[model samples]
Target chain A: MTNVKVTPLTDLHRASGAKMVEFAGYLMPVSYGSILAEHRAVREQVGIFDVSHMGEFVIRGKGARRLVNDIITNDCSRLAEGALQYSVMCREDGTVVDDLLVYVVRDDQVLLVVNASNIEKDLEHVLTFDRNGADVENVSDECALLAVQGPRCRDVLTSCPLFDDVREQVERTAYYHGFSFTHGGSEILVSRTGYTGELGFEILVPSNLAVEFWEAITQAGRDYGLVPVGLGARDTLRFEASFCLFGHELNDDTSPLEVGLGWVVKLNKERFRGIETLRQEKKNGPKRALVGFELEGRNIARQGYTVLKDGVEIGKVTSGAFSPTMKKSLCMALIERSAKGTEGVYEIAIRGKTATARLTPLPFYRSRAK
Target chain B: MSFENMRFSKEHEWVQFEEGSNLVTTGITDYASGELGDIVYIEFPEVGQELKSMEPMGTIEAVKTVADIYAPLSGVVREVNTVLNDDPGIVNQSPYGEGWFVKIEMSDRSELDGLMEKHEYDRMVGKG
Candidate 1:
């Protein structure tokens, strides 16, 4: 077996009898009790996920915003301080390097969060593109993140005493914005942003204090039915939100345009990596567009399953599951833009058998705001 | 039938032959259900279908993964769990009781020789 890494909360997850799986080199929990229950906890009440495996980088110095904007496809120039912008970095070929969140710290500073597996490559890419030699520090090993998500997330967090002194600030942090608090003499950052469509917060803490925060918050949310969710529920929640997960809807071969992320690409701004190519793809439209589908019955089409039209290969499923919320076997497939004329129905090959699937919107479920 | 007399397959299925009879009832083992997580769907072989030894008989769909339920021995399916159609979570809740997937009539009495007893199956699954 490959020697896998473990996050700060690995021991705690093990103590909770979580099913651990190797994900991005870290031994992360796939589920604690049931993925379905964990999924419902996030949708109906609140749930927490130890997303410490994600990578973090701090960029500072003059022109940092401009330089960061020059690297990511999204427009960061108009981004206000204390706000986070959904962004992606692209290679020169217009294919995605990684989809990330750019926390605009200030005019001369920003923090970038990337997929855990792409830390080295993303760091190298940013450093290579740093013409001014702006300070870009990788803090992936030192940081831990917990995603507290759902409609009751606001209440759960506001009730937690971890940062009670800044309770008002925590409660008032606007969507996509964050506030810093003092925890054990170290700066802790919590942002009102998450992959789940629910009103949620992503708390970033020092690696040493991850467990403390986990315990404190889980205790505070006991009445709210907060549970320690694993990566399995995290995926289902994000999938229902139609969030683009790297290595699924995005990769080195897939452009933002193909994944319905054109909204994040600021083509009007000054030249950035892949600008010309992405602009060209935007004008002509991507060859394929990501779409969601449901198999006619109970069968599921997992990642890389073929999507066919008229007995011919058309596309492939990127991510799929028996969605807990939707109560159906649904999947997101990147089909040829021409597959639209297939009359809303396509076939998925599951275990060598052809199952009929019909096109649906990207998100199979949306949280009904209460 | 109690779980004490059950035989297990390497694929994580449990079979218990009725006392002094050809009929045997089968279901996924507890270890199988634990590994599969919450079961969302189960596809059962039709009643009266011939099931060859160690061959694909049906499928078990969990929230995260899907695996084919294989026959542990040569047999003919006499009954398939119809309750799984409306409430599949029973497979995870009661893998040895209400969750039994199929009842089969043994085609060859000696086919059970290849199966593992509880201790052996537990050892194979690394629990014993």
Candidate 2:
């Protein structure tokens, strides 16, 4: 096997006593101390995640907005300057290429932040958009992103002089909005969006300043109970929020509509690639839908585990874990629409044994009010 | 604490042989439980089942991943710690005592000669 790539903060993670593991070809921290502890830290107070592995691309030149709009599912023209929108790029067959967050930095400048695994494909897709007076460049290697997320995130950022001028700007910047600011003598972009379903901010800074900036925020937020979270908690937190993961909940063969993200698709707008297939799917309905469930027993259903009803295999688990907050095994699955209403006890084929499971609503764990 | 009489395997299993009854009480070592995280479920092998050394006897599901429990010696399953069905967390809290997975009637006591002692197992795991 090829060697896994290490981020700039690899030493920091090791110093913090994080349990490092290979994930998506990167040697990343899976947990700092304990998965449950890190998971709870994000739910109650604040947690920081090294998200430098995600890909970032810059689209410049005139007609950039039009070109980007024609490529993505979301209507890019609707985004005002300094706003960000979540959308999906798709194949002609309506399958998702990648779900991305597009930032409208200026009328002619757009930034696309995509999943780490889909960087190459998304870059190729953007290049296929006819240019139309636009120039797309992949800038993933030059930038490092960090996420400080939780209810107490705003309070933590208040102490940084780098964020002082943008404090009010960030405070008022509603969800999915971003603003450019100077941090530690470097230009930084702060976005009030996160995948954890909590109020937080994502900061993009120069790769060189990543370690210094991470240490500064972590030290400042210590009193507020900010822990250096790892990808393990990141997955659990996102799973609890009903967010989709790249290969598990979504893939090149799964469309946004099939996963309950049809709201981002603009079917009526000027024709874009994959419009015909998506329109047809919208009318016919997806064959399978992503649904959440809470297993009755402690048996943790995992990816590729078969879901059974009445002793017959009906579907498969995409992502599953024992939720720290609820203290129960929870999962999300892509099952046939007909299996929706079938109640009573279901089973998950774990190993060679059939363990009983139950289907509950999504967001198995809800954040408590402070 | 009397691990001198107990034999261990590289997989972190410990077997304590009862001299008189020729029975073995098996449990995972503290290192195994710590690495596996909180134990959420434990599937025990049925009584009267014969198990070969190094063969999988049952499965243990933790919060992060599922691991198979291997037999440390050739034996016939005599009893299982049924309390684990309701309180599987015992494996994380007290693995050596109440977290014991099964008791077996030793079929081939010579298998113990192939297993490592606590000190040897520790050295193999780089913890000695």
Candidate 3:
């Protein structure tokens, strides 16, 4: 227990009657009240999440852009200052190391936001690939992240007087773009990005001021029916959106091409890690494909459940849930590419019984993010 | 119908035996419902299905996780509260009252002697 960590807002979550659980070695809130209610609040009204468990790293120096582009699949060189691009870093074998968001601060300074569980691994990967001696520092311990999400997210954000200095910029910040603002003696970064398929903003605050910033956002969101969401709702929200969570949709053995993230590969660009294999896979297609499916009934198809076609094992489930928004049992599975000819139907082995599941479109829920 | 006389299982199910009849009513405890967060679906055992003591009887699905509902004693399922078919949240809202999962005709009434009281069950779950 001594090795487990707690985010800066953990005490406040406990004070608000949140049910806490261990996730990625941190004792985080699973829900403040009901996960179903918290999920609806984000879809129908607004919600706030303490996502401070995510990792942050700042890479600076003359070789920063090159180091980033060489390590990640996306072309960071194309990003304008203040722009963010989602990308996956892979080993030479074309398997993913981590999926991250790259924030371009300047031509020579960039920030990488990574998965909390992969901080140590990602840091070591970046350092090892830093042929140009780029200064890479893990700032996760000093940073905290908060996400305010919903259709009325902008209204809720601008209502906070603390954001007066950047209210205009906040309203103008395009999707995937960010701007930094300073107050008192500290600085914060605000970006129009989120895991939920909702119009939202993620704010990177200093660890010391995380609670204060969260309180300000919560106060401003009260009139708009903002609920304090937890990790349980966070996962269901992203699952409905079909977002590829690192461990679920990707791992050291899964390539970006197989998980439907090929758009970020940018094979036409300069050589990067795993480019040779990804380029080859692009021409021949990946061996496996990720597809969305809905079960015939309410029974869930849990992660790692065996997927079968014609009574033969095809693959396994990656993520599954009873989507509160869709009101159905849904899952994403990684199946053999040859098995895609099953005529849109497959069988999922659930609790020792075969349950019928049918192929559905990628996202079961439509995004109102724009 | 007071829960004071109800016996609880180590698995967090509560069983109430009628004084004159062999019929027993059972459901998950309030602590079980609270730990499950928001229940979205429950796959109840079919009527007339035989249940063995401490064996899995059904499935309870919440938004985050799923767990098996275990039978507290040996019996045959007499009836399932079908209302839970469309409104599983009732389990989270009223775990003791309307959320009762099933009624069973006890196979061995002597099994009640091995069950725990509310206070002991609470102590086991660190609620006492």
Candidate 4:
């Protein structure tokens, strides 16, 4: 295995007694003290996360807009400048290469933020297909990101003296909108997009100023009960909201139609990778569908666990956990659409014994946001 | 917290075999809870169910991982702590008292001989 890269907040996290673990080639804190405590902080109050390991690619030059439009599933033509969009890039066979957030900085300049584990593959995908010849640069190591998320996020950010120049704009910014804020000669891009199903802001700044910015955010959020949450809570938070985790819910084998992400694929985009297959699947409603389930017993149906119907294997669990908020064991599984309305029930094979599970709705939890 | 009269297993479950008594209480160790991060669920075995030594009893679900609880000794379960059904977090807060998993009627007194003492268990966990 390669050496794990350290984030800018590594020493600070160690000082706070965080349990660090290897995740996506980065040595990141899984939790500080308690995963439950950090998870609650995000749901009830506010929490800050050091998400600097996420990769960013900058595309600019004459045909940048055309190049980006050709790559992603979301309609880039509809995006106003400074607007953010959640989209996916796919291989020719319609399987996901990576899901990313596209920040339309300008008509000819775009910033694509992708998952940390897929950075190399995403960069190669963009660079390999050089139809438009845009200057694409992967500057993941030079970027630092922080996500301030929760119900009280705006109030806490508004109270921060460090963000005074853009205080009014920050408070007024609508969801999926991003704008530049200048701090000490550097332009920090703050967006209203977040993985957690809550009102939040993701700030991208230069790596050198990350420490100072982290301290400032922490100082301002002291009155709002904000804490530094690690990736452990981050997973549970996103999972509860039914977001598609890269390797778990989504992978190179599953189509967007199977995971309920077909809405992002613009069928009228003229031409793009996997367009025909995605269109065909969308019309026929994909052979498989993703469904949410509740395990009747305390045992959780984790990833890769076989989901069965009448003792016959029909699907596999994608992601699952005991929800801290709901106090129930919830998970999402990918099953054949033909088995959708099976009244018998579902089961997960656990240690040679079959554990009963109940098929439920799509998402186990929904945020207050529309 | 008093392991003086209690015995432990390498799987991290603690057992207290009373003198000349057939019933003994069992609970997961604090070390196990700390390693699991947060206790979200504890599947208690049904009372009167027979379990074998080192065999799987049920399961312990945490936020990040799910683990199986092993029976420390061969016995028939007498009672399961129902308090954990309402709030499994109690296992993390009080692994020794209210967090106890179950009580079992030992089929054989010699089963306790296979269990480890406090210091022995601690050494096995690298905490000694």
lDDT of 3 by residue, A81-136 (tens): 99999999999999999999999988888999999889999988887785597898
For model 2, how does the per-residue alpha-carbon lDDT over A29-131 read when each residue is reduced to its tens digit? 9888677777788888999999888999988988889888998988989789989998888989999999899999889899999998888888888787788
Candidate 4 residue pairs in clash (backbone atoms < 3 Å): none
DockQ of each: 0.84, 0.51, 0.86, 0.80
Candidate 4 per-residue lDDT over residues B1-128, each given as its tens digit = 56788999989999987898999999999899889988888877899999999999988888888899999989999999998988888988898888999999999889898899999988999999
- The Cα local distance difference test for each model comes to 0.88, 0.85, 0.91, 0.89
Model 3, runs deviating above 4 Å: A131-133, A342-345
Interface RMSD measured for model 2: 1.8
Candidate with the larger lDDT of 2 and 3: 3
Model 1 lDDT tens row, A140-228: 99989999998898888888888678879877788889888788988888898888778888999999999999999999999899998
User: Which of the predicted structures, 1 or 3, would earn the higher DockQ when compared with the native?
Assistant: 3
Candidate 2: where are CA atoms >4 Å away? A1-3, A343-345, A366-370, B17-25, B45-53, B74-111
What digit string (tens of lDDT, one per residue) describes model 4 on residues A109-200? 89999999999999989886765668999989997999999999998889988788889888888899988878888889999988778889
Which is better, 3 or 4, measured by lDDT? Answer: 3
TM-score of chain A by itself in each prediction:
0.97, 0.95, 0.98, 0.97
Where's the lowest-lDDT run of ten residues in candidate 2 chain A?
Answer: A361-370
Largest lDDT belongs to which candidate? 3
lDDT string for model 3 (B9-119, tens) is: 999999987787889999999999998889989999999999999999999988777899999999999999999999999999999899999999998999998999988
Comparison by TM-score, 1 against 2, better one: 1
